[model samples]
Target: MPKTKKLPLNSLEWHQHPKLTTLLSGDCHQLSTLPDLQFISFAQLQSILDSCPIPVVKRAKVDAYYLLAPMPILKQLLGHPDSHKLTASLNIYSEPEPTLSTLALIKPALFYQKYKRLPEILHSRLDKAKSMNLVTPNKNQISQLAQISPSAFRKITHSQGGSHG
Candidate 1:
Protein backbone atom coordinates (compact mmCIF):
# COMPACT_ATOMS: atom_id res chain seq x y z
CA MET A 1 0.00 0.00 0.00
CA PRO A 2 1.13 3.52 -0.73
CA LYS A 3 0.58 6.53 1.52
CA THR A 4 -1.25 9.52 -0.02
CA LYS A 5 -0.82 13.14 1.05
CA LYS A 6 -3.93 15.15 1.93
CA LEU A 7 -4.13 18.73 0.75
CA PRO A 8 -5.10 21.47 3.20
CA LEU A 9 -8.61 22.92 3.07
CA ASN A 10 -7.97 26.10 1.07
CA SER A 11 -5.85 24.15 -1.39
CA LEU A 12 -8.75 21.85 -2.20
CA GLU A 13 -10.59 22.56 -5.45
CA TRP A 14 -14.26 22.49 -6.25
CA HIS A 15 -15.45 21.53 -9.68
CA GLN A 16 -18.77 22.51 -11.25
CA HIS A 17 -20.52 21.54 -14.41
CA PRO A 18 -20.33 24.22 -17.04
CA LYS A 19 -24.10 24.14 -17.38
CA LEU A 20 -25.11 25.12 -13.86
CA THR A 21 -24.13 27.76 -11.31
CA THR A 22 -24.75 27.64 -7.58
CA LEU A 23 -27.19 30.11 -6.13
CA LEU A 24 -25.26 30.87 -2.93
CA SER A 25 -21.85 29.36 -3.55
CA GLY A 26 -21.20 30.36 -7.15
CA ASP A 27 -17.46 29.88 -7.14
CA CYS A 28 -17.06 26.21 -8.03
CA HIS A 29 -14.21 25.93 -10.51
CA GLN A 30 -14.71 24.53 -13.98
CA LEU A 31 -11.76 22.18 -13.67
CA SER A 32 -12.00 18.78 -15.37
CA THR A 33 -10.36 16.46 -12.81
CA LEU A 34 -12.96 16.14 -10.02
CA PRO A 35 -15.10 13.00 -10.30
CA ASP A 36 -18.41 14.36 -9.00
CA LEU A 37 -19.41 16.15 -12.18
CA GLN A 38 -19.03 12.89 -14.09
CA PHE A 39 -21.27 10.81 -11.85
CA ILE A 40 -23.86 13.21 -10.41
CA SER A 41 -26.43 15.45 -11.93
CA PHE A 42 -26.64 18.95 -10.56
CA ALA A 43 -30.04 18.25 -9.10
CA GLN A 44 -28.90 15.09 -7.30
CA LEU A 45 -25.81 16.80 -5.92
CA GLN A 46 -27.89 19.70 -4.70
CA SER A 47 -30.36 17.44 -2.92
CA ILE A 48 -27.44 15.76 -1.18
CA LEU A 49 -25.93 19.12 -0.21
CA ASP A 50 -29.25 20.30 1.16
CA SER A 51 -29.50 17.14 3.22
CA CYS A 52 -25.94 17.26 4.59
CA PRO A 53 -25.35 18.04 8.26
CA ILE A 54 -23.88 21.45 9.10
CA PRO A 55 -20.51 20.27 10.35
CA VAL A 56 -19.72 18.41 7.15
CA VAL A 57 -20.45 21.55 5.15
CA LYS A 58 -18.16 23.69 7.31
CA ARG A 59 -15.34 21.24 6.87
CA ALA A 60 -15.78 21.19 3.09
CA LYS A 61 -15.76 24.98 2.98
CA VAL A 62 -12.43 25.10 4.73
CA ASP A 63 -10.89 24.21 1.38
CA ALA A 64 -11.15 26.36 -1.74
CA TYR A 65 -14.69 25.06 -1.84
CA TYR A 66 -17.17 25.66 -4.56
CA LEU A 67 -20.70 24.41 -5.17
CA LEU A 68 -22.40 24.76 -8.54
CA ALA A 69 -26.07 24.99 -9.49
CA PRO A 70 -28.37 27.60 -10.90
CA MET A 71 -31.57 29.18 -9.65
CA PRO A 72 -33.48 27.97 -12.71
CA ILE A 73 -32.57 24.40 -11.78
CA LEU A 74 -33.85 25.16 -8.32
CA LYS A 75 -36.90 26.74 -9.89
CA GLN A 76 -37.53 23.76 -12.15
CA LEU A 77 -37.00 21.40 -9.21
CA LEU A 78 -39.33 23.36 -7.01
CA GLY A 79 -41.62 23.36 -9.98
CA HIS A 80 -41.94 19.53 -10.22
CA PRO A 81 -45.46 18.11 -10.04
CA ASP A 82 -44.32 16.01 -7.10
CA SER A 83 -41.87 18.54 -5.74
CA HIS A 84 -43.59 18.64 -2.37
CA LYS A 85 -43.13 14.91 -1.86
CA LEU A 86 -39.85 13.99 -0.21
CA THR A 87 -39.99 10.24 -0.14
CA ALA A 88 -37.51 8.09 -2.08
CA SER A 89 -38.29 5.26 -4.43
CA LEU A 90 -35.77 2.70 -5.78
CA ASN A 91 -32.83 4.65 -4.31
CA ILE A 92 -33.89 7.90 -5.97
CA TYR A 93 -35.16 10.71 -3.75
CA SER A 94 -37.43 13.63 -4.38
CA GLU A 95 -36.38 17.06 -3.30
CA PRO A 96 -36.77 17.58 0.41
CA GLU A 97 -40.13 19.07 1.33
CA PRO A 98 -38.42 21.93 3.13
CA THR A 99 -36.28 22.79 0.11
CA LEU A 100 -39.34 22.98 -2.11
CA SER A 101 -41.21 24.84 0.61
CA THR A 102 -38.48 27.42 0.95
CA LEU A 103 -38.37 28.02 -2.79
CA ALA A 104 -42.16 28.40 -2.79
CA LEU A 105 -42.01 30.91 0.03
CA ILE A 106 -39.31 32.85 -1.78
CA LYS A 107 -41.66 33.31 -4.73
CA PRO A 108 -45.09 32.05 -3.81
CA ALA A 109 -46.52 32.69 -7.24
CA LEU A 110 -43.68 31.27 -9.33
CA PHE A 111 -44.88 27.70 -9.01
CA TYR A 112 -48.31 28.69 -10.20
CA GLN A 113 -46.81 30.46 -13.18
CA LYS A 114 -44.30 27.73 -13.94
CA TYR A 115 -46.77 24.81 -13.83
CA LYS A 116 -49.70 26.70 -15.41
CA ARG A 117 -52.23 24.53 -13.56
CA LEU A 118 -52.17 26.59 -10.41
CA PRO A 119 -55.22 24.97 -8.97
CA GLU A 120 -54.24 21.42 -9.77
CA ILE A 121 -50.74 22.06 -8.58
CA LEU A 122 -52.12 23.27 -5.29
CA HIS A 123 -54.56 20.39 -5.24
CA SER A 124 -51.90 17.73 -5.64
CA ARG A 125 -49.87 19.10 -2.80
CA LEU A 126 -52.75 19.87 -0.47
CA ASP A 127 -51.82 17.19 2.00
CA LYS A 128 -48.16 18.07 1.80
CA ALA A 129 -48.96 21.70 2.50
CA LYS A 130 -50.93 20.72 5.56
CA SER A 131 -48.22 18.38 6.72
CA MET A 132 -45.71 21.19 6.47
CA ASN A 133 -48.09 23.34 8.56
CA LEU A 134 -48.89 25.62 5.64
CA VAL A 135 -52.26 26.81 4.41
CA THR A 136 -53.64 25.72 1.04
CA PRO A 137 -56.89 25.01 -0.72
CA ASN A 138 -58.22 21.46 -0.65
CA LYS A 139 -58.24 19.15 -3.65
CA ASN A 140 -60.84 20.18 -6.28
CA GLN A 141 -61.79 23.11 -4.07
CA ILE A 142 -59.93 25.56 -6.26
CA SER A 143 -61.73 24.21 -9.31
CA GLN A 144 -65.09 24.57 -7.63
CA LEU A 145 -64.28 28.09 -6.52
CA ALA A 146 -63.24 28.95 -10.03
CA GLN A 147 -66.36 27.34 -11.51
CA ILE A 148 -64.34 25.36 -14.04
CA SER A 149 -64.97 21.77 -15.07
CA PRO A 150 -62.19 19.25 -15.03
CA SER A 151 -62.22 19.13 -18.82
CA ALA A 152 -62.18 22.90 -19.16
CA PHE A 153 -59.55 23.10 -16.47
CA ARG A 154 -57.44 20.60 -18.38
CA LYS A 155 -57.77 22.66 -21.51
CA ILE A 156 -56.83 25.84 -19.72
CA THR A 157 -53.94 24.20 -18.01
CA HIS A 158 -52.75 22.62 -21.23
CA SER A 159 -53.12 25.93 -23.03
CA GLN A 160 -50.66 27.41 -20.59
CA GLY A 161 -48.16 24.63 -21.36
CA GLY A 162 -49.59 22.67 -18.41
CA SER A 163 -46.61 20.71 -17.20
CA HIS A 164 -43.04 21.85 -17.57
CA GLY A 165 -41.66 18.40 -17.03
Candidate 2:
Protein backbone atom coordinates (compact mmCIF):
# COMPACT_ATOMS: atom_id res chain seq x y z
CA MET A 1 0.00 0.00 0.00
CA PRO A 2 1.14 3.52 -0.70
CA LYS A 3 0.51 6.54 1.43
CA THR A 4 -0.82 9.72 -0.11
CA LYS A 5 -0.09 13.11 1.41
CA LYS A 6 -3.11 14.97 2.61
CA LEU A 7 -3.70 18.40 1.13
CA PRO A 8 -3.15 21.25 3.58
CA LEU A 9 -6.37 22.79 4.83
CA ASN A 10 -5.27 26.20 3.61
CA SER A 11 -4.41 25.04 0.11
CA LEU A 12 -6.27 26.82 -2.70
CA GLU A 13 -6.68 23.39 -4.21
CA TRP A 14 -9.65 22.95 -1.92
CA HIS A 15 -11.75 24.84 -4.45
CA GLN A 16 -11.58 21.85 -6.77
CA HIS A 17 -11.28 19.28 -4.01
CA PRO A 18 -13.40 16.19 -4.60
CA LYS A 19 -15.58 16.76 -1.56
CA LEU A 20 -16.54 20.25 -2.70
CA THR A 21 -17.05 19.07 -6.26
CA THR A 22 -19.38 16.31 -5.06
CA LEU A 23 -21.31 18.77 -2.92
CA LEU A 24 -21.68 21.10 -5.88
CA SER A 25 -23.00 18.14 -7.84
CA GLY A 26 -25.78 17.82 -5.25
CA ASP A 27 -24.41 15.13 -2.99
CA CYS A 28 -25.23 16.48 0.44
CA HIS A 29 -23.53 13.62 2.22
CA GLN A 30 -20.26 14.87 0.87
CA LEU A 31 -20.52 17.70 3.35
CA SER A 32 -19.83 15.36 6.23
CA THR A 33 -17.02 13.81 4.27
CA LEU A 34 -15.12 17.11 4.30
CA PRO A 35 -12.49 17.91 6.88
CA ASP A 36 -13.34 19.92 9.99
CA LEU A 37 -13.25 23.63 9.13
CA GLN A 38 -13.37 25.07 12.62
CA PHE A 39 -9.91 26.59 12.33
CA ILE A 40 -10.27 27.85 8.77
CA SER A 41 -9.23 31.50 8.39
CA PHE A 42 -11.29 34.29 6.82
CA ALA A 43 -8.79 34.73 4.02
CA GLN A 44 -9.06 31.04 3.25
CA LEU A 45 -12.83 31.28 3.20
CA GLN A 46 -12.58 34.28 0.86
CA SER A 47 -10.49 32.21 -1.48
CA ILE A 48 -13.06 29.47 -1.52
CA LEU A 49 -15.85 31.99 -1.95
CA ASP A 50 -13.96 33.47 -4.86
CA SER A 51 -13.68 30.09 -6.51
CA CYS A 52 -17.12 28.68 -5.76
CA PRO A 53 -20.16 30.70 -6.69
CA ILE A 54 -22.51 29.86 -3.86
CA PRO A 55 -26.02 31.08 -4.55
CA VAL A 56 -28.46 33.07 -2.47
CA VAL A 57 -32.07 31.95 -2.58
CA LYS A 58 -35.31 32.61 -0.79
CA ARG A 59 -37.27 29.72 0.61
CA ALA A 60 -41.00 29.56 0.06
CA LYS A 61 -42.92 30.92 3.05
CA VAL A 62 -39.72 32.37 4.46
CA ASP A 63 -39.18 36.10 4.62
CA ALA A 64 -35.42 35.87 4.64
CA TYR A 65 -32.82 35.09 2.01
CA TYR A 66 -30.28 32.35 2.56
CA LEU A 67 -26.73 31.94 1.33
CA LEU A 68 -26.24 28.37 0.22
CA ALA A 69 -22.79 26.83 0.26
CA PRO A 70 -21.35 23.46 0.94
CA MET A 71 -21.39 22.71 4.68
CA PRO A 72 -17.63 22.92 5.07
CA ILE A 73 -17.55 26.36 3.52
CA LEU A 74 -20.38 27.49 5.77
CA LYS A 75 -18.45 26.18 8.74
CA GLN A 76 -15.55 28.39 7.80
CA LEU A 77 -17.85 31.40 7.66
CA LEU A 78 -19.24 30.48 11.03
CA GLY A 79 -15.73 30.85 12.37
CA HIS A 80 -15.40 34.35 11.07
CA PRO A 81 -14.93 37.23 13.52
CA ASP A 82 -18.35 38.65 12.72
CA SER A 83 -20.04 35.27 12.55
CA HIS A 84 -22.09 36.28 15.55
CA LYS A 85 -24.20 38.17 13.05
CA LEU A 86 -24.95 35.06 11.02
CA THR A 87 -26.89 31.87 11.48
CA ALA A 88 -26.48 28.57 9.66
CA SER A 89 -28.45 25.36 9.26
CA LEU A 90 -28.53 22.36 7.01
CA ASN A 91 -31.09 22.69 4.22
CA ILE A 92 -33.23 19.77 3.12
CA TYR A 93 -35.82 20.42 0.49
CA SER A 94 -37.07 18.79 -2.69
CA GLU A 95 -39.20 21.38 -4.41
CA PRO A 96 -39.33 24.85 -5.95
CA GLU A 97 -35.56 24.60 -6.02
CA PRO A 98 -33.89 21.49 -4.72
CA THR A 99 -30.99 22.10 -2.34
CA LEU A 100 -29.70 19.75 0.33
CA SER A 101 -26.84 21.47 2.03
CA THR A 102 -25.95 24.34 4.34
CA LEU A 103 -28.01 27.54 4.43
CA ALA A 104 -26.90 30.77 6.15
CA LEU A 105 -28.96 33.71 7.23
CA ILE A 106 -27.27 37.07 6.97
CA LYS A 107 -28.34 39.09 10.02
CA PRO A 108 -30.30 42.33 9.62
CA ALA A 109 -31.67 40.03 6.93
CA LEU A 110 -31.83 40.71 3.26
CA PHE A 111 -35.32 41.62 2.03
CA TYR A 112 -34.61 40.93 -1.61
CA GLN A 113 -34.58 37.35 -2.81
CA LYS A 114 -32.63 37.55 -6.00
CA TYR A 115 -29.84 35.24 -7.01
CA LYS A 116 -26.30 36.56 -6.45
CA ARG A 117 -27.63 40.01 -5.69
CA LEU A 118 -26.18 40.35 -2.21
CA PRO A 119 -24.77 43.81 -1.60
CA GLU A 120 -21.07 44.04 -2.43
CA ILE A 121 -20.31 45.70 0.91
CA LEU A 122 -21.74 42.72 2.76
CA HIS A 123 -19.09 40.50 1.22
CA SER A 124 -16.44 43.17 1.64
CA ARG A 125 -17.17 43.41 5.34
CA LEU A 126 -17.01 39.68 5.77
CA ASP A 127 -13.68 39.59 4.01
CA LYS A 128 -12.25 42.66 5.71
CA ALA A 129 -13.56 42.41 9.26
CA LYS A 130 -10.69 42.81 11.71
CA SER A 131 -9.73 39.37 12.89
CA MET A 132 -10.71 39.40 16.52
CA ASN A 133 -8.88 36.16 17.10
CA LEU A 134 -11.98 34.20 16.16
CA VAL A 135 -10.08 31.76 14.01
CA THR A 136 -6.32 31.93 14.26
CA PRO A 137 -4.64 31.22 10.98
CA ASN A 138 -2.58 28.12 11.41
CA LYS A 139 1.00 27.78 10.22
CA ASN A 140 -0.13 26.23 6.99
CA GLN A 141 -2.49 29.11 6.32
CA ILE A 142 0.17 31.69 7.09
CA SER A 143 2.59 29.88 4.85
CA GLN A 144 0.02 29.72 2.08
CA LEU A 145 -0.66 33.44 2.28
CA ALA A 146 3.03 34.18 2.34
CA GLN A 147 3.46 32.14 -0.79
CA ILE A 148 0.88 34.07 -2.78
CA SER A 149 2.25 36.97 -4.82
CA PRO A 150 0.96 40.46 -3.95
CA SER A 151 -0.56 40.76 -7.41
CA ALA A 152 -2.38 37.48 -6.94
CA PHE A 153 -3.84 38.66 -3.65
CA ARG A 154 -4.92 41.90 -5.28
CA LYS A 155 -6.58 39.96 -8.06
CA ILE A 156 -8.44 37.81 -5.56
CA THR A 157 -9.62 40.84 -3.63
CA HIS A 158 -10.57 42.81 -6.70
CA SER A 159 -12.32 40.04 -8.62
CA GLN A 160 -15.58 40.67 -6.78
CA GLY A 161 -15.24 44.44 -7.41
CA GLY A 162 -14.10 47.55 -5.56
CA SER A 163 -14.48 47.38 -1.80
CA HIS A 164 -17.49 49.47 -0.87
CA GLY A 165 -16.46 49.47 2.76
lDDT (Cα, tens digit) per residue for candidate 2, span 1-165: 111222222321222223325545644432233344546555655566545443434444433333333334555554566445433232222221333233222411343333232334333333454354444454444334334322223212456553342
CA lDDT of each prediction against the hidden true structure: 0.37, 0.38
If scored against the real structure, what TM-score would every candidate get? 0.20, 0.26
In TM-score terms, candidate 1 sits at 0.20
Q: Using TM-score, give the best candidate's number.
A: 2
Identify the leading candidate in terms of lDDT: 2
Residue-level lDDT of model 1, residues 98-151, one tens digit each, is 343343355445555665565455444554578898754544544453445543
Clashing pairs in 1: 9-63, 21-69, 22-69
How displaced is residue 63 in candidate 1, in Å?
A: 61
Q: Candidate 2: where is the Cα deviation over 4 Å?
A: 1-39, 60-63, 66-71, 82-165
Assess the local accuracy of residue 165 in candidate 2 as a C-alpha lDDT between 0 and 100.
21
